[model samples]
Target: MTTNAQQQLQRYLRNARYEVLPLRGVVEQVRELPAGTTVTVTSSPAKGTEATLDTAARLRDEGMHVVPHLAARLVRDSAHLSDLLARVSDLGLTEVFVIAGDAERPAGRFTDALSLLRGMEEIGTRPYRLGITGYPEQHAFIPDRMTIQATDEKARYADYIVSQICYDPNTIASWVKSMRARGVELPVYIGAPGSIDPSKLLRISMKIGLGQSMRFLRKQHGVVTKLLTRYTPENVFDELSPCLVDPDYNIAGWHLFTFNEISKTRQWAIEMADRLQEVPA
Candidate 1:
């Protein structure tokens, strides 16, 4: 590889972060990560917002910087938001990721990420950093225009944007450019799946769509010798290397979706970091 390209790739890997679902045993999985690694725990309808906070608290106690997803729809009102923020402050958290959440109905007045972000300031202790979501590909339910508008609105309140998982590197690269054209300049954390079982990834891709399934297969062709075996993010990272460090893109780093496969993902990250260090940059 060219020296410039190799240097960019190394920079991206060095700043990589991971996202984890709030599921059972997830805390133990997170303990495997190196101390100081930034971990963002996701909130889901199944696990609830408390689960996300609980996981983040554990990670914090483990000496890692934790960014918990505080889903707006799940929060009941200003009182609830205040309590959550106080808890976060007590834990010494400096960052959070806000989302509209997957709940079918809002639990209180705040229904979107922007509303919640505004509420965050009202709580008296604002996190040092806040993140909102971006979608490179169209969201499953929301229209493209609406999503763009929401992003633009939320960007004002957010320090950064974590993109929804998109498999195609070219699509991600183009989307980042479009975001800048639309005047949203928040640094983007590109989301990619970690070292997950191929079968699980396929099931998820199929649920997303046949087109995404095909793209996943094609993208993994270079990384997975056998289709049903374990899959890593090497191909996606390699393909995205250039855009990741390009000044025009305003790219930050990775938000690896570990899917609770933290052990394998952590090992893969270590191996990749070692390999990058061995390279003559």
Candidate 2:
């Protein structure tokens, strides 16, 4: 007989996106992962888009479902965009994460996520799934209205929205309701920081563009921020737990920002899933 815990894990495992940091241990971690793992590799706009493409290829060769992050600012023109699509197709990559990457300046012509999304569609690149970032907290550069509009625009081509990390559950829950009210009906995969280390989590957040959320961490002495590394869904699920009993929010599952501390993140997830089992759901 299948245990309730196992059943829950199976259900979540079916659709969850495992965000793999493109670090030294990624290939090793992917090699040992089970078949169901669909890994999304996020890259820096400053680092160059090809790195993300290469990471996805490596993950694909390891027989994992790989989703590459295509930072909008990094994509130059139609030819560069087409080349990426062709490369992705050749690598058997079926999903991609589109973001207005954290770059001091655009490498070329593209400026934002919507522009890149439009380019991909016009270029005829149809991945099985496309994901865009959602910010619950105040965005650093853009206003909230523009952020919502951006989501709406990208929602046309993207299959899902992966939320940026927000410490407050109320912000997330409220954001989800607000998103639906606006008719941006893409399925949402909540981005929860995976268990790693406090200091590392702080460094990682700033490195990957947490923006205003970083200020909160600074004020809190990195208390809430530490959860990004020291705990997995346990911290986030606590915030979203009410949704499990009654689906108030459209959170499909979680997109763990496992900052390449794969083993610790994996262990925390396994433990949390097991703990959720005893809850008698």
Candidate 3:
């Protein structure tokens, strides 16, 4: 029923979900990637949805399985949502990652991610897979209880949860357990840093209000702030290893906050996974 090669390939897939923040020439980043690895291109409320959909379509042409973040804050109305979904269908895209998105003020009727998810369901735009963010640590702006409520509501629509990158593996393990206790059974993609310029990553994390990931930065303030630190997936593995090796946890894979640092992160992961194989597995 199983082969070592098959199992190792599955593990590699388990550890690869690239988080693409919209920045200078992200399309180039997408075009250069190894085929078959999932890439999620996130759109902020500030970034226009048309721009995102267009980019998604282009990446689809390149044969990347791009899951575009349809930021609810940016969409204007049902008509706009319809157009967006139509684009996805036209591109043959199957997955979407929905987020409430950060807009200083709502540009349209949809206020949060759940509303958009509901709209998608109502409009008959049911994607094959939908992903939502999970906060292992507290959200800075959204109160903890509200965060739980929001996630619960989204669980009805989303297929899986991707965490805001947290450095502590113990925290990740505990949070996953907590989520299960709270009855959120959707599988999770553990968020983590991928050996990039830690300061840039921290700045971006704080800017995005990435909840626990920001706190993770503050936790390492003394050392991180001064030096140009590089945080690798090892921090995540410390907690994730137990789950990855266990059956109960069902820790699906990794969601890397590439911060558009794809070359460095991807290389690091390839090398790390290779090294793991050599360590007497």
Candidate 4:
């Protein structure tokens, strides 16, 4: 029998959730989402954080809830930080997600997420809500202990935690347990991939350097390879169902990494919601 927690998890996913990179056609794609739907824009080393904020501004203008990723290593200094803040303020942005970024080297004094969080405090125009990244599985380059320490340190400044893309439910559940054990209690938005074909999925995975996860997925050759064929979060949602309802887990919702496959992903979410509605939830 599915538990009530599982049901809530399924229902939560039915609500609009999208994570988009700053790419071509994204604005048009986001326009199709319902008003006030949550949309997070990602920062890319190649395209820069400006692209993220610009996309967020357009979404905000269109009446959507926009959250821009503020990559720490990308900010040059306090002046740059203030300019970025001013832009978001002008756009009426209320939330932001902070990360250490994937840059090979820091662009300025801020080398990590905590530094950027502190800079926001000093600037005194911080967003109403702040988010930090969490990794259920080990990060490709950072040690697990370092990742844990970073999460713990940044938890105080964050309103919520959006986990990095993780394919294993067991790993996610276990990570939640570990978080609680270590006293990190922010609400978590579990990350899942949107419907993406193999070629595109591999491209984004490589672009983001998700080495450890790609390796893990590759070990399950049939399933991992098929992820290239037609990707959906059906199995992922099912596996995460129990965790959502568990009193011990502070799971808030889902964060769908759409990878620019916005239209198809939205359709999949709608169909999944309808299917869940027909079931005994």
Candidate 4: global Cα-lDDT?
0.84
Candidate 4 Cα misplacement greater than 4 A, ranges: 1-7, 206-212, 215-223
Candidate whose lDDT is highest: 4
lDDT of 2: 0.74
Cα lDDT of model 4 by residue, 159-178, tens digit? 99988887777888999899
lDDT, ranked from best to worst = 4, 1, 3, 2
Q: Where does the lowest 10-residue lDDT sum fall in candidate 2?
A: 1-10
lDDT digits (tens) for residues 1-281 of candidate 2: 13543464545634456787676668888776666588888878545777788778888878888889988777778898888878888887778788878787876777888888888778777678788999888776778889888888888888888898876666788888898898877778878777767777777666656665666545555555544444345666665765533444555777888877666667766777666566554
User: Of the candidates shown, which would achieve the greatest TM-score relative to the real structure?
Assistant: 4
TM for every model, in the order presented, reads 0.88, 0.87, 0.89, 0.92
Candidates 2 and 4 compared by TM-score, better number = 4
Report how far residue 46 has shifted in candidate 2, in Å. 4.8
Runs in model 3 deviating more than 4 A are 1-10, 13-15, 209-221, 226-230
Clashing pairs in 4: 5-245, 198-228
Clashes of each: 0, 2, 0, 2
